[model samples]
Target: MMPWLARSIYRAQEAALKRPTFAYWQALERSQWLDRAAVEALQARKLNALLGVALAHSPWHAARIRAAGLHEAVRAGELPLADLARLPTMTKRDARDNVDQLVWRGVPGGAFRYNTGGSSGEPLIFHFGRARQASDAAGRMRARNWWGVAPGEREAYLWGAPVELNKTDRIKTLRDRLVNQLVLNAFAMSAPHMDDYLAALQAWQPKCLYGYASSVALLAAHAEARGIKPRLTALRVVCTTGEPLYPHQRELIGRVFGVPVANEFGSRDIGFTAHEAPGGQMLLLSESHIVEVLDEAGQPVAPGEAGEAVITGLSSAAQPFIRYRTGDVLRLAPDAATGGQGLHVIAEVSGRQTDFVLAADGRVMHALAVIYVLRATPGVAQFKCVQHAVDRMEVQIVTDAQWNAAAGAAVVAGLRARLGEGVAIELKLLDTIPPEASGKHRYVVSHVPLPAGLMVTA
Candidate 1:
């Protein structure tokens, strides 16, 4: 498809879906250049708008706003950014349990249901509106522009979603072509499949390659091992997300792809929060988010100090996640802006670590391969996958009332299907799954290490 035709189709799809993506993108393109004070002022306006929506629709947030004595201020649009601290921060549990009170089903453009990828151990089913969707899409467009990639340009996605992967119908394929996207499954990266992926990329010659950091890095490693050099001449950049991009992984990916590797920081819950610049600074989407770095006691951390990232999504009006505690630890850059841009800077982000699962056939797969299986199973409250050996896998699951013997069998069957028929599956039901000694929750831990030559350095 021609780029012009693809751009038209992309715009048509967004309009049909009632997502104000291009309009938001246009705003983002300009707002990114605003002065610091002006950008913060813009954030204040958006923040108050979000608060007004929460007060009018979300009972949970309304109560908190009232309790914090900001109801009048919200209505009057007088709430300052500093006053946001008065309201309590919400946890993942709170968002999960109080979804009904938090979501506005009748929100403009309608609300949609989504489930987290379960990187947090416990999968959260949440609702978001088209505005939130638009925010994420538009934010990415602005970020990609920083690397000279435009919307509707040929881009390849090494992403995985059961729904997307299962829909192999002609219409879905056509839609992908119309939007200039080629989605290769990150969940299925067997040696043979990776060879096909390399061939596909060489043929497609996408302007950008985007996907999970580990998956992309693994592909690069596979290419190096096989001495296969992909000829993607049009490829401008490799964008990595869904995990912290380690320095060595970045170096490996950049060298293998012959392009600069950009790391994107965000989560399924918070939408697109930040992106890396060519100069290597991670710039927050200040127009769409209010980010606060807080210490263990919930007090604001000094600049340059690491702390948990608590966020307020200004576009999340359908399901207001005001001051939502994202367990990821990050440090703010000492400077407020980089390269004269007003977007807040992040010095470091460290969390969401997923291990690689080695299959019995020696095919290296991303941990999400098994994670998708467990996450889709009903009655699973919390779960973890530990690969003890090539043929030994242990699953610890905390179940709800929906759990049954059949679900247990299905879990075992799913594990065997991915890990191999010869692998021993141990399903252990527990009331609670404990975190690591460092208090971090790792949903997938592989005791079986990768082969000596294939190990990805930290």
Candidate 2:
């Protein structure tokens, strides 16, 4: 069947089902128009209802609240955020260890099960119900609206996840076509495969583009080096997720794609949480999740201070994430004239805390720092860095269509320049870099311990 025909049929079926796409858009508009006070009040009410459900249904929360000496009548507005410290912060391990105990027994039917990417080194399986899933989808729609791509507009998704060309996937692909979306394979980012990607985008003529920041930036770099400027006139916005958007990357993508670039910060477990507004302000999606920044001692950090990000899901009922600890570091923006109702805009966010490469000289560097140099080199596709020993490092590369010794040389030179002399660097050619067991790619991996007293910055 023709791709267009398949998409049309799928869309018809979706419309028949009365999918929540339109309702979600209306809800997003309402939330965006809300004043700070109104948003907070809605959040407070939702928080109180969630707490009530948690106390009644979740064994884990019931025990924790009892241990903290909190009663069932704790109103959300009156409940101090600081008082949450009394209950232990939940982690992936805790969920994995107590999945059933964490779920709300009153939730009708079965729960929606999912696995974490183990980006921080431990994969966890979790469960949440239908309501949480719907809320998550609504939050994503709100972020897309920030880029001016509404429901039924053409958009391209360059995201991760296995592409099973089975019946279920076919049905989903058809449905997405009706909603005007094309999904490009994020796993196939090798130089040899990029031409196919560019061709797909040209054919699709999407109104907006969305994908991982690093992947899109790499493709943009490839386009620039090759002088292949495919006219993407339909493209109005380029949005990136899954990784932090560095200043250089953001600029390069905007220049190459000829569109304004927006950054979205989120996780699959919690859904879309924050989006960079059109005015260049990082706005927290306060309606979806309750966000808090805390120092090393688990105390609330002052506004504009850098600290650990903790999130509590207002929508998730199957697996209640009350004050869940996210491993990423972030800095909060100071209150400005833009209605600061104790909500801090994100100034900067460093990606996963564990993606640091340990150097032999006792220095730890962000994996992205090394990626900067590698991306500058021409004719390189996907690459991964592994530290074998204190003084030795190995780089795995998948080259462009015209693969040669030059590509390998570029990869070696890039690493040597960044890591300095006396460090042995080896480049190995690979058909493909395998994802971790949890199905997410890691740019860097280190076996050595980080130097003493070195801490990750937000």
Candidate 3:
């Protein structure tokens, strides 16, 4: 199937499913070309609308707005972004504790339940609807256009999402072929499977390769070790997500793939926050999110200084994520960093990193694979995964009211599925989960070290 034709057909189907998706996609296409002032104006309009909707439907948000004395300003569309600093910031704990109070479950298109295996300790199951979906899909489409890759173009995902890897039906296989997508499992990237993944990618000749930063770097390292240079003609850019892209990793991935590496900064909670531009700017999807870089004192930081990324997702009408603290440290880039693109710019975001979990069968899996296990398990508060040995894993959990005995069995099953049979899993319920000496919460700590020269981190 021709790439262009596949995109057309997929979009037609998407339009039938929700006409507004295409409308938003097209609007984003034009929005990117708008000036800085215009883009900020659009963000203000959307934020006001989001606040109004949240106040109308969600009593939790209404109380906060009213308490801040900004409810009148929010309703009158006169609230400035700076004034939002006066309001209390929303934490992950706040979202979890007030799920029912925060969600407008009966909004248009209906709020659908979604879960994120976040790198942060708190994994949340929340409700999202048409607006969030459109924001992500359309924003990604526009980002791809920057690299000359269109929707439905031949792209391979080296992802660990269970939903993508679990499909074994003939119908689903045919659908993938029609859409020009090839998915390689990053869940099991052993030397043997890495050889097979390389073969599949070579045969597919995808124009873009997208997946976990560490996994992609591991693949590139493996390719280098074997003295194998992949012969991919159409490949343009390799995009890395799921973790921070270290300098050496980026250099190696680009050198091996014969292309530039584009780093994407976002999490499961905040959908499609930002992507690297061709000019190397980390441009935020300002149309979808309002980002605030704050200092330790809870005030906005000077440009170029490192601070926490406080985000307000403009499209989260079904679930109000107003002034949400993402717990990520980042710095706002100056205009020079963006090439004057005028989109909100991020100089750098140093999110946390976890060591690779080694399977009993010599397979190396991304930490998120196990992190997903703890993240989706309800009733678990703060948690940690420590791979003590090949077959040994210790899970420490801080339970809230939602904790139950069945969650331990589910954890064992989930870990066994990824680490293989005979894997030892012990669940410990704790009063508090402590941070490391560095005051950082290392969600995953794999004591299993990689073979010499196999490490992607410095």
Candidate 4:
């Protein structure tokens, strides 16, 4: 199928199912021209409606709303933003435990089920409807416009495999081409493979390149070592998400791709949260999400003060995630909403970061690939993958009642499938898998150094 025709059909199908998506996109584009007050007021209206849905449909949210005494507000149809703060923050554990009660299967656009990638070391299946999908897609479309790239323009994705996806590569490639997008597997980013990816992107002439922050940086390092200078005529920007975009990574990616590198902040559970603007500010997609930065005591932090990222999905009626604790640390930019389009600004997002895993066959993959091996295993309460060499791995698993010999076999089989049968896997059951001295939980840690070609010269 021709890229243009395929994308047109895709847009049509999407518009049919998510009727309000393009309207929301157009509305958000107009909102950028409005003041911050207007944008947030719109958000407030949506938040109240979402709360109403929770009270009426979601058993878990209903219980929470009643316990918080907000049912009266729901009855009166006047749940203010302040009233929402009264409810307890929902944790990942809570989401996992209450999936049945929290999800409204009969959501207007219907509910689609999916699971998180477990990058947080905890995985859970959740349901999202067209509204959630529309918010993410529309929000991303707006952000791309900042760099002068429109939807349906050619783009490339350096992304990980979907958790437990059973697709054949041929079908995946065909889908990518139809959408005018190219995908370089982040799950298998070996040095040689990255060289090939660079060549493909240069030939594809994609207007934008979207990828994990570290994966792109690592590729840039490889390109410099191989002395392969690429000059893609149409490349406009490189948008990096999934993890924090370090300062050095931004510089390296920009230098290699010959375009500005933008940082994106969000997670699987919370949909799209924010994107970096052309003006060097990380702007929250406030139309879709109501983000609150809170201190350890759960009090709202002052602007510019770092706090945990507590988010509310205003459009998520299928599954209400009100005041959800995202675990990521961030702060509002003191100057957020001042001049640059009322989109709220994030000073920084202190989020997940992990090391790359080296496979026995000399292939290097994102840590999440190996982490998935443990994450999907039933016995794992928590797990950490430590690589001492290309072939040897130590999986430290905090086992629960679900732990069994079959769980052990499943873990080994999953790892071997990805890393190759030559790779040696050792399972170590633990009472507790503690964080590092820095108080950070690293799911995948590699002591092995990257080969000279893949190393970044700081």
Candidate 5:
């Protein structure tokens, strides 16, 4: 499809859905050039507006606002950005338990229910308004443009979202065609599937390739081992998300694709937060988010210190996540190191690392392949996968009231389908799932190492 026609179709679709994506993108492009003081002023204004909505509609946030004595300040639109720390940080459990108290169902453009990706071992269902949707879409657009890939350009996604991968309807196919996009199922990346994906990518010649960092790196390794040099001359950038892009992974991906690799930092709950620039600097979307690095005691970290990223989503008016503590750890760059923009710079990010599971047939697969199976099962509150051996797998699960014998059957059947019927799956029901020794929740851990000649990096 021609780029012009693709852009036209994309614009029409956004209009039909009443999404303000283009408008938000335009605003973001302009705001990126603002000075630091001006950017903070913008954040203060949006923060105050979002807090006012929470105060009026969200009982959970209202209590905190009043207790912090910021009710009057919020109402007056004078809430200082610094005073945001006065309110206690919110946890995933808080949002899950107080959905009714935290959501404004009557928010403009309506509140839509969605689920987190469960990469952190805690799947959460939350509501977000159209503004949050627009912010995410627009932020991605601006970031892609930074790498010379304009909106609606030819792009291919190496993703495994069940909602999208499960769609076999003609409408989904037509949408992909009209938008000049291709979706390859990363969840089913057997040796043959990876070969097919490489061929499809070469034929399609997309301007950008995007997917989980680990999956992308694995595909690169597979291609290299097979001595298949991909011919993607149109490819300008390989955008990696959903997990941390390790240094070695970055080097392998860039070398294999013959392009620069851009790492995106964000999550399902917070929307699109930041993206790496051409110079390798990660710039936050300052207009839509205010990020603070906090120590273990919830106090702000000093300049140039690594800490937890507690974010305030300005566009989350429907379900305001004022001081939401994201489990991922990061370090902020120096305040003066803005990289010619007002957006905050992130020096380093350490996020969840998923293992590569080896199948009985000797095919290497991304850990998400199995994760999708457990996440789809009913009554699964929390889960952890430990691959004890090639044919033996242990699955620790915490179940809710919805779990039953049928759900247990589903888990075993799903695992068998992916790992081959000969593989043994040990299912253990647990009261709780513990974190790794480093205190990070990794949903998937494999004891089986990668095949020889394939590199696994830290």
Candidate 6:
């Protein structure tokens, strides 16, 4: 049950599965030496490899790449980024419509296939193999290392997954404990259930914590409200994913945990895209994937311009995503005169499409404004805003100690300020907010169909 022994066993199993741990480590280490030119060279190699694979086995890519005027001998850098842009972005519907054709038929069977939670309401199934899985894990490990976390260190994962109490799940849980991981159910982020989360953290004493940003922010708020700062001296860093880590949420989490909080931007489909480096730099992991910032017309956005993010995975051969539209907006960092790191920098992520609240003026307002106000309020553990209709909205709250009526009043006042007075605000206390079936926490959910006149100004 020793940590080292558990790691050895896990490594053995991974090796048996033909996972590329050693190769992945070598690639990651090599990335430290990469400059923009070197990254271009590496991407060229990956593109060539991917192109060869696609042409030989993938019917979908074979036809499309040829039609796009891409040649097998062409280097990635030689194939202008704009040339790749001409290939239309593939949506979840495309995959569902052409799953068999999308896959490389030459690859072995049993390649990993998983569905993303589709927080944007368009879930898609994607494929990968053991190699891609291993590379993704190793890339994540490299990011965690930036925060001083090692393989054997104790870590707690606050995540939402189907809880299986069966024999297999019990065995898996036991295995996780041996490897120093405690999984906290993200589905139970309600007020009453928060005590159990606190107790688990106190007992587990993990050195690092990982979870959705909203859930961890709620835990921090809960702890601050109850004055129940569990002696989590074992904890050193907190890594948040699955939702945007607003500035206010980051401040509260860092203050409550007494640790540096790092925001990770990625998805199950794309793997890890960016990690917050030391000294507050958002370093894009270009070695693992290629990212493009494109404007409304699918033209590449200049540095420092805000645009949609398009990504392509270099490691995934099971089903390649070449210039796939990610649907998230991002702003590129200002170009550095010295070009310190080869990795691109992200100035900001506008969060998800799902985080919009329907306003009284018949316009949908982004949830960032509401999140900012709630984080400013005291004694708010966690909150979810749901729009049942144009005029009716429900704000679910989970607090640590007593619910402060003044705090509630302040939130309502803030809401009324942003949304008009005609909008109905209902405050409901919940023990926990359940995650969707695909295991994602939705901050805002609107049942109303997209309005015809609605527009996104920013």
Give the best candidate by lDDT.
Answer: 1
lDDT of 6 by residue, 308-343 (tens): 888877776788877778877888786531336677
The candidate, 2 or 6, that scores higher on TM-score is 6
Looking at model 3, which ten-residue stretch has the lowest summed lDDT?
Answer: 163-172
Q: Please, what are the lDDT tens digits per residue for candidate 2 over residues 97-152?
A: 78888887557544777755434433456787766665656666666766776646
lDDT of each: 0.89, 0.68, 0.85, 0.84, 0.87, 0.70
**What range of 10 consecutive residues in model 4 has the weakest lDDT sum?**
116-125
TM-score-wise, the better of 5 and 6 is 5
Which residue pairs overlap in candidate 2's backbone? none
- Candidate 1, residues 1-458, lDDT tens digits: the string is 88888989999999999999999999999998998889999999999999999999999999999999999999999999889999999999898789999999989999998877545688788888999999999999999999999998999999864523354755777799789999887766777888999999999999999999999999998898889878789999999998989999999998889999999999888899999988889999999898899999999998799999999999999899899999989998868565678889989999699998988887777788888788778888899989999999999999988899999988888878877888999999998888999878899999987765567787
TM-score of each: 0.95, 0.72, 0.95, 0.94, 0.94, 0.75
Can you list the residue pairs that collide in candidate 6? 190-431, 190-432
Assess the local accuracy of residue 252 in candidate 6 as a C-alpha lDDT between 0 and 100: 84
Off by over 4 Å in 4: 1-6, 16-20, 117-120, 162-169
Per-candidate total of colliding backbone pairs: 0, 0, 0, 0, 0, 2
lDDT score of residue 162 within candidate 4: 51
Error of 2 at 275 (Å): 1.0
Worst 10 residues of 6 by lDDT: 449-458
The list of candidate 3 runs beyond 4 A from truth reads 163-174, 336-340
Q: Which ten residues in a row have the lowest lDDT in candidate 5?
A: 161-170
RMSD after CA superposition, every candidate: 1.9, 11.7, 1.9, 2.1, 2.1, 12.4
**lDDT of each residue in 23-111, candidate 5, tens digit only:** 99999989988888999999999999999999999999999999999999999999899999999999888987899999999998899
Q: Report how far residue 75 has shifted in candidate 5, in Å.
A: 1.3
Candidate 6 or 4, higher TM-score: 4
Residue 230's lDDT in candidate 2: 67
Better of 2 and 4 by lDDT: 4
Ranking 1 against 4 by TM-score, winner: 1
Error of 2 at 361 (Å): 34
